[model samples]
Target: MIVSKVSKYNTLNDFLKSKTFMKIALSMTGCKNNRYELDQILRWAIKNKVPVVEESEADFAIINTCTVTSIADRKSRQLVRRTRNNNSGLKTIVFGCAARAQKKVFEEITEVDVLLGSMQEVITYLESNISDMKKCDDASLITSGEAFTRSRALVQIQDGCDNYCSYCIIASARGKSKNRPQKEIINEINKHVANGFNEVVLTGINIGAYGASLTTRPDENKFAELLEAIFEQTGIKKVRAGSLGPEFFNEKWYKVMQNPRFSRHLHLSIQSGSDSVLKRMRRNYTAGQVTDVIKKLRGISPDIAITADIIVGFPGETEAEFKETVQFVKKNRLAKTHIFPYSERQNTLAAKMEQVPVKLRRERVKKLQEVADICRSEFIKSQLGKKAEVLWEHSRLSGRAEGVTENYIRVRVMGARTAGSITSEVLTTENIDTLL
Candidate 1:
C-alpha cells in the first residue's frame, strides 16, 4: 500500500513490540544516514528477540531503497523481485528514498505488501498490523547502542535536505530540513559513550545545514554549537562527521576542530570543482571557497585528512571544466575521493539540460579515478611511521585484526587483538595493506 501520510503512531517503539515472533530479512542500498536507520530496525529486532533470517527463510522482508541514481533504482527493484522469488510467501515492505521518489514504481511491483515514504509511515504501519504491541522498556534503545555486530555507533543528529541542487533529487525525496534537539543528540552520544563505543558518527542528508530549521537557536553556526556541546557533555573518544558542505567551515567550526576529540578527517561534498559547473548545478559554494576551507583545515593540523565527493561529467561540462576538477582534486592532495559519473534523475533540473554522452561520462570517471587513486596512495604513504588511533572492527585472518584509523585510513595489524578495542599503532608499510 502507498503511504499517503503517517498514521497515529507517536514513537518508533510502538511498532517494534509484537506478541508473536516473526523472521525478517533486511536489505538496503544508500548512504550512511539510511544505513543508520536500518541499524535501528535491526537493533529493535534484536532487543525484542525477533529472528533476522536469510531471505529464503524469512516470512517478511524489509527493503530500504535508494534512488540516488538510475542504477540504484534498478537495484532496489531487483532486490524486491529477488526476495519474492526466493520465497513466494514472503511479504515485502519497501521504504526509503526510492519508494518515496517513485512510489508508483514500487506499487507496480506485485510482491510489495507495504510501500512507505518515510520512517514515520513505517512505524505507523507496524503499529497497526502487529498484534498485542507494547512500548519498549528501555527508551535508550531509540538512540544509544548499535547492533551487537558493529564496533562504532552512528547517531543521526538531523534528517532531510532543503538545498535543491540541480543535479540532486534528495531534496524532493527527503523533503525539508529537520533538526533533532541538542539535548536528544547529547543524550544519544552519552549513551554510546557509556556502551563502550569509542566512536560516534554524526550523520544526516545535509549535515552542514543542521540548525537552519531550528527555532530555539539564534546562532548561525548551530552545528558548531552542537559539536561544542558533544565535546563538553559526552565522554566519547572520537566524533566523526558525515559528508558536509564547504560553507560549514567557519571561525566557530575551526575553533571546535582544535578539540582533540574531533576526528581529523573531513569529507567535503564538492560535487564539481569547476566554478561554471558548480554555478550550473546551483551549489552554494565556489571552488575558491572550498580551497580556502581546506587550506585552513590543513593549517590547523598539518597531517589532517581531507576527502571529498566529486561528480564527474555533469550536463554540459566541457573538457576544460572536467580538467579543472582534476586539477582541483590533485592540488588538494585529498586523502580519498568518491567519484561518480553523473546520472540523470527524473524531475531534476539537470536531466533537462544538455546531457553528457554515456561513453564520455565513463571515460571521465576512469580518468578521474586514476587521479583519486594516486592521491589516496600518497596520503596513505604520508601516514607511514606516524602514530594513529585505530578502532578495531573485525578480523578476517587468524591472529590478525583489521580496523580504521582516526583519519579514516584502513589498516591491518598482526597478532591477536580484540574487535572492539582501540589501540595506537605506528603505521608501517608492512602493516598497511591495500596501499595501491
Candidate 2:
C-alpha cells in the first residue's frame, strides 16, 4: 500500500485531485493570523468536497506554525512531528511564519510533504499541478471571505507589518503591509452576521495601522471611517479591535472607540515599559505616552479594560531599566499584561547585542508576572457587582458556561447557554478566572 501510494503521488495536486473526498486535519500554533489562515483553508477544502477530520484520524494534516520566539519555533516543529506520528501514513503540510522563515528546517523533517509560506501558496498548490513548492515562498496575502466561527467572527482587515522591531522576524516572513478594501471588509462582516455571528473582532498584524497607505478622498480618518461603516452597515451586536500598537492612538480613533457599537476593551502593544528598553526595542511609544493614552481611555469609559504586551528583559537591559518597567506597571494599574521574557531571534539586531542571561530574564519575568497577577485580581474585583454584557462561548467548566465580558474578562456564568451575547450582573468574583 505504501509503494502504491508513493508511485501514484508524484505531486500533491495530483494526489488531491484524484480523491473525491479526503479527511484532513487543520491545526495552528500561533496568533489570530494563523487561525484566519486555517479557516480559509477549511473553506477551500469544503468547496472541493474534502472532509476535515481530527489529526489522529486523517489522511493529511495541515499545520500553521509560528516562529515568533525560539520556543515558538521549537513547538512548531514538535507539533508537525506529533501530527505525523499520531497517524501513520499521514501526509503533513507545514506553513506560516515558521515554515516561511525556516523552510530547510521543515524540509529536513521528512514528514512535511508540502512546505508553503502563505495562504495564497496553499491555494495555488491545491489548485495547480506545480511540483516545485519552493517558488511559492513569500507569497502575498489573500483575502478570506469568511472565517469559520459560530459565535464571534474575526475579520482580517490588514496583513503584514512595517514596524521592524529589533527582536522580530514577522516583517520578513509576512512581507510588506497591506490592507483589504473598505468595501470588502464590510461585505465579509455582513456574511458573518448573516451566518448568525453577533460579535465581530477586527484583527491583523498591525490593525491600528489600517488605511495609512490608502488614498483617502479628503479629510478621512481611515480606521475611524472603517469602524463607523461597520457599525452603520452590519447588525453585529459587539465589535472588538485586535491588538493595536501605541503609535496608532489618535483623537479620531479615540472618538470612534466612544461609540456604543465598539467593545470597551482595547489591547495595546506596549512591548516594554522602560523608555530605554522601548527605544532599544524600536517601539514608537514611551511608558508615559502609554499612560496618557490609558488615562484618556479611562476618561471616556471608567470601566474600560486596557491590556498590554510587555517584554520583561531585553538585551543589555539593566536592573534599573527592569525596575522602571515594574514601577510603570504598578503606577498605571494595567488591567492585564501579556508578559513574556525576551527571546533572541536570529538575523535580528537584538540578537547581535549583549545578551542578558536566561536565568536573569526568567527571574524578572517571574517578578513582573506576580505584579500582573495582582493587577488582574484588582481589575476583576472592580468588575464585580456591575452589569456587563457577556458573550458566552463554551462550557469549559462544570455546571457553568464560559464567556468573555465586554471588557475582555473571561467569566463562567451558571446556567448561561452558549448563544448570542447577553448582559448579566456580576454577582460574585469567586470562581471567575482572572486571566484576560
Candidate 3:
C-alpha cells in the first residue's frame, strides 16, 4: 500500500487506469487560505482520477499544517504521527506553515516521506514521478486556490503577510505579502460562478494588505477598489469580503461596500481593545480607531455582522487593560469575537517579554468568552423573525438542511434537502447554534 515510490506507474493517467488505485488522504489544519490550498491538491487528485481515501485506508497521506500558536504546532505534530500510525504502510508528506516554520521538527519524524515548503514542491514531485504524462491544459483549474461547498466557494485572492504582529508566526511561515493578479482573481470567480456557486469569499493571510507591493496604474483597483471592480465586472451575485484590519476601513471602503452585492458581514482583526496592548502587539490600529470603524460600518448597515479577533493575555497586560477590552466588547456589541489566550511564539518580540501566567491568561479568556457568547446570542436573537438568503451547504442527520446567511449566521432549515441557495423566512430561534 506504500505508494511513495511512483516508479511502478508511468504517468498519473496510467495510475488512474491501473487495476490498483492509489489511495491518497489529504488533511489540513489552519486558516481558510490553507484549506483553499489543500482543496487545490484535492481537486488535482480528482481530475487525475486518483482514489482519495480516509487516513485509515490511505496508501499515502498529505498533511497541510498550521503553526499560528503553540497548540496548533502540537496538533500538527500529533496529526503526522496519527496518520502514520493509522496505516503503517502509508507515506506521510507534510506541508504548509507548520512544516515551513519547523522543518527540523518534521524531518526528525521517521514517518514523513517528504517535507515541503510550498505547493510547487507537490507539483514537482508529481511531475518528476511521471514518465509518459501528458500535460493537461486544465491542470491549473485544480491548482488554483479555491475551496468549495455546495453553494459557496472561497477563493484565495492573496497570500502571506507583511504585518509581523508581535505574537504572530505567520510572517515567518507564509513570508512576505503577495497578491494574485486581479485578472486571475476575476477569472477564478468566473469559473466558480459558472459551476453554480452562489457566493464567493475573498480570503487571504492578510487580505486588507492586498496590492501593497504591486505597481498599480492610476485606474487600477487596490483592495477596496478591487472589490468594487469585482462587483461591477463579475456575474457573481453575493461576494463576501475577508478579514480586514481597522486601517483598511475608510471613505473609499464605505463606497465599495455600499454595493448590494457585498455581504454585510466582515471579519475585522482587532488584536486587543486596549491601546497599550495594541501598541505592544505592534498592531497598526488603535482601540479608538477600531471603535470608529465599527461605528461607521454600523451607520452604513445597522445590522452588519462585525466579527473580530482578540488576544486576551499578552505580556505586560494589566487587570485594567483586560477590563478595557471587556468594556470595548460590551460597548461595541460585536456580532462575534475570536478570543485567543496569548501563546508565546519563537522569533517574536512578545515572546521575549515578561510572560503572563497560564492561569491568568485562561481567566481572562473565560471572561472575554462570556462576553463573546452574549454578543453572538444577541445577534442571532435580532434575526429571530427576519428572512435571509441562505445558501444550503449540507444536510443534517435530523432531516434538516444547514447553511449560512449573508450576515454569517449558521441557520438550519427544517426538513430541507440538498437544494441550492434560497431566500427563506427564519422559522424559529429555539435551536440556534452558539459558538465562542
Number of the predicted model whose lDDT against the real structure is largest: 1
When 1 and 3 are scored with lDDT, the better candidate is 1
Q: Taking the tens digit of each residue's C-alpha lDDT, what string does model 3 give over 1-436?
A: 1233343233333544442445578887888887788777777776675556678867568888999999999999998988888888666778889999987777777677777888667655644543344433444333332343556778888888777888988988988778889888998889988877778889888777677772111112278878877887789889987788787666888888878788889898898999999999988778998999999888888878999989988999999999999999999999999999999999899999998899999999999999888988888788777767766777878898777777878777677655457565563664345422
Model 1 C-alpha lDDT versus the unseen true structure: 0.81
Sort all candidates by TM-score, best to worst. Answer: 1, 2, 3
Candidate 2 C-alpha error for residue 383, in Å: 1.1
Error of 1 at 29 (Å): 0.3
Q: Which scores higher on lDDT, 1 or 2?
A: 1
TM-score of 1: 0.90
Better candidate number, 2 or 3, judged by lDDT: 2
Segments in model 1 whose C-alpha atoms lie over 4 Å from true places: 1-20, 133-145, 214-219
Q: Which stretches of candidate 2 lie over 4 Å from their true place?
A: 1-20, 129-148, 214-221
What CA RMSD would you report for each candidate? 4.8, 6.1, 4.9
* TM-scores, one per candidate: 0.90, 0.90, 0.89
> Each model's number of backbone clashes?
0, 0, 0
**Candidate 2, residues 379-434: lDDT per residue as tens digits?**
88887788777787766546787777889888776675755556564646664665
